[model samples]
Target: MATLDGNLVSADDLLPLALTNLGHFTSMRVDADGSIRGLALHMERLVKDCKAVWGADLDTGRIREYVRQGLDGQSAPCVVRVTVYDPKVDMGHPADADEPHVMVSVRGAGAMPPQPLRAMSIPYERDLPEVKHVGLFGVLHARRAAQLAGFDDALFVGRDGHVSEGGTWNVGFVDESGTVVWPQAPVLPGVTMALLQQHAEHRIATVTVEQAKGMTAAFATNTSIGVRVITAIDETELPDDHPVLSQLRETYLSIPGETL
Candidate 1:
């Protein structure tokens, strides 16, 4: 994917659309097993979001057809992304209007990283806090900072001093009581997190950074990475032999054809 005017551009004509102006959008990944995964849920949310922001008659059927045609002949185990921008206005409105624009791209699958990742805290905020969008400068910045700090990614600390999420994944933590907690704010509704919620015998809560320290184990979830255990956070390291993370890793690997 290419960047034009700070937005992800797959074709020249899509350059002018503001992906964030729409009420709802989705960023989904199609794995090698030919599974669409959370595409339906993403689309459902997109409709609700688009309706809230742009009003009715957003024509989601048009968007779905666009995705189907765009990905008709792609290989298995590839990554696909579709963005719906401002659908309520044309060129006259602000650049961030919600006229929807669909974009698609694919990349070859790669092996997963073995070592557990570490994360550091950083600042971020979601404008809508409901639907996904194409603006990711904060994620890019956090990833760069994580690389410089010798880690895989960064955990966003929202203005309310709560743990929001990782650059591209939803955050999870196993508290000292052996309970799992996932905060609802400052995070996108992740498909992988939904899967984990279904699979794990755990609980969920709107957690805080101070409460995060009481966690004995931490991890993140995304379609690409599945479930990734967090070994360290800001110099606080969990034991390599921690059983909770080990079990989560094992459960993750048990999924058929889920390898990175």
Candidate 2:
């Protein structure tokens, strides 16, 4: 039902990595015909993060094969997650493993949330902000805490109150004049955000949580949710309907997908 390096494996085998949490991963969705959005960028991300974390060369071809095997005979428009890590070595030194391997899991895609997100800011930042890694203790805790406190998700803010990103998505705002403004801070270079920039007009600026209140509209980006509206960040309510966001959604959807 799942694939580990192109071979069938039980989910139980992955439990071992939970102990070390020394892994990097990328999760993406496959279209009805098994095509992925920004496939090349996704592959590039896997190789780059793997090399950075493990000092090992990860094969994109092998990863593609693994993805194919995982998707075959399964539902179309599915979700695929590829994790790279080493199971051996202590000190959780996965870099010493003979070679880093990827575990690919394919499952039915989830329906996008119907409601817009409401986020509360937390004064925290991720370690190794560039890599899409599996170390999620701090991030997850923040999200949970926010959810329990009455917000939909948590937004990460620096000590200066400058917003960085969301627990799982990249945050973007539209200024009063209809320009896309991405907060200037350390954030994972998300594949969705990367694809969007190629198709939309956006600029980066240093914006604090206090400054976001002045924005006309806001949205969050990720593979799963594409470009989703964020109704509020803390107590700042942004417009739910705006020409900039509508144009952004259309531009993002227009990008043709690539086969793995």
Local accuracy by lDDT, each model? 0.65, 0.85
lDDT tens readout by residue for model 1, 2-83: 2222244544445445432332446555665666665656667667766665554445576656655555677765665555
TM-score of each: 0.77, 0.95
**Model 1 segments beyond 4 Å from truth?**
1-11, 18-24, 56-64, 86-92, 95-99, 112-115, 246-260
User: Which prediction has the highest lDDT against the true structure?
Assistant: 2
Please report the TM-score between candidate 2 and the true structure: 0.95
| True lDDT of residue 105, candidate 1 | 50
Predicted candidate 2 versus true structure: per-residue lDDT over 149-171, tens digit per residue? 89999999987779999999999
Error of 2 at 76 (Å): 2.2
Candidate 2: global Cα-lDDT? 0.85
Highest-TM-score candidate: 2
Task: Give me the runs in candidate 2 sitting further than 4 Å from their true place.
Answer: 92-95, 112-114
